[model samples]
Target: MLSTKCPNACIRACHLPAWQKAEEDVKSLLKEKLLPALQRASLKAERARIHNVIGQISGE
Candidate 1:
């Protein structure tokens, strides 16, 4: 969940021309944005795994 209290510096850093100009900016963007999205996805995957394990244990 993105914090309601904005990280203005991070947000600014993400938007800077220098940040955009960096060769690794795409990777940086991914690290800044997609990483959290991936983490959330991983959490969901783990939850599903746990649910499946419980279901199997319960013979469901």
Candidate 2:
């Protein structure tokens, strides 16, 4: 949604309370830590698909 709406400008985030330091900390954690972790996990999940022959016996 951000990309579609703000194509002319860069993506913006709200980092209120400049002195809190938590804003920058959270951003770095997301970019450096969580991003890669989620990407890898997603790839593994994508590669995992059902490739078997099975049939369920209904009303058994």
Candidate 3:
């Protein structure tokens, strides 16, 4: 068992297994969800930019 004070100065007991589990969950979430979501958003923004450029070229 480990005890430490948080940034707010509140003392709490920490469990090793729970901490490890939380870390693994965050890693899994980033790998499985956040990366792809960010990539898709980037692609959409790029496509929109290209579309605007093409429209401007055609208008000129």
Candidate 4:
């Protein structure tokens, strides 16, 4: 059973048994590894964008 607090993204899995196991495995990976890597990549990309903008403003 899923609580009302469940994220909208995960709501489907709660109603579908076929998706439940795969969802759990993916969630574990996201917690243990994938989410951190994704966050790091996002930060790196944002940093690069900021640097580029600054360089353009400064005529680098």
Against the hidden reference, what TM-scores do the models get? 0.39, 0.24, 0.42, 0.40
TM-score of 4: 0.40
TM-score: the better of candidates 2 and 4: 4
| Model 3 lDDT, residue 45, Cα | 60
Write one digit per residue (lDDT tens) for candidate 2, span 1-60: 122224673222332233124434443454554467777565444333110000111111
Question: Cα-based RMSD of the predictions, in order?
Answer: 17.1, 19.9, 20.3, 17.7
lDDT of 3 by residue, 1-60 (tens): 222334443222333344445545554454554467777566556555444443443344
Model 2 misplaced stretches (Cα beyond 4 Å): 1-35, 50-60
lDDT by candidate, in order shown:
0.42, 0.33, 0.45, 0.45
What is the total number of backbone clashes in candidate 2? 0
Q: Encode model 1's per-residue lDDT on 1-60: one tens digit a residue.
A: 111134542322233344234424443444554467766566556555444433443342
Model 4 lDDT, residue 32, Cα: 50
Clash number for every model?
Answer: 0, 0, 0, 0
* 3 against 4, candidate with superior TM-score: 3
Of 1 and 2, the candidate ahead on TM-score is: 1
Q: RMSD in Å for candidate 2, one decimal?
A: 19.9
Name the 10 consecutive residues with the lowest summed lDDT in model 2: 50-59
Ranking the candidates on TM-score from highest down gives 3, 4, 1, 2
Model 2 global lDDT (CA atoms, 0 to 1) = 0.33
